[model samples]
Target: MNNKPVGRAPNFTNACIVMFGVNITWVLVVIWSLWGLLAAVFLGLGVNHLIERGRVWAAARQAASIRRGKRF
Candidate 1:
């Protein structure tokens, strides 16, 4: 039996794509106004931070489930 944990590569890829898209939109906004650019940067960073935190939380939850021998 293959007993390895599932990797989070797909989740990481999705996170990167989402962040990249947000940054691109922010760049466009920057061309419209300085304040918009600042807001985009701040919001983008905050969102990305939240996503990372969620990822960590999910991973921990999965690990706990595995320890309990619970299958999803």
Candidate 2:
């Protein structure tokens, strides 16, 4: 088998963006007493993290299946 790399690079860029958003959200919502928006931001972050993990898991599974010459 060839030594081609599998999958894409690490998701540090998105992580950084998410962290920046959280910081800004915390600053604005805390000062303005907008607790609802803060909660929404955290919930959205949770969903985003889940989706990212799911994509990575799916890609890993697909890569493994490809290596084994089976249908993913």
Top TM-score hit: 1
Compared with the true structure, what per-residue lDDT tens digits does model 2 show for residues 27-49? 66674565666676776677679
Q: For model 1, which pairs clash?
A: none
Q: Which pairs of residues collide in model 2?
A: none
lDDT of 2 at 53: 100
Q: Model 1 over residues 1-72: C-alpha lDDT tens digits?
A: 999999865458788889988987867587548666667778678878999999999999999999999964
Off by over 4 Å in 2: 1-35
After superposition, which runs of candidate 1 have C-alpha atoms over 4 Å from their true positions? Answer: 1-34
Taking every candidate in turn, the Cα RMSD to the unseen true structure, in Å, is 8.9, 9.7
Provide the TM-score for each candidate, comma-separated.
Answer: 0.52, 0.49
Q: Count of backbone clashes for each model?
A: 0, 0
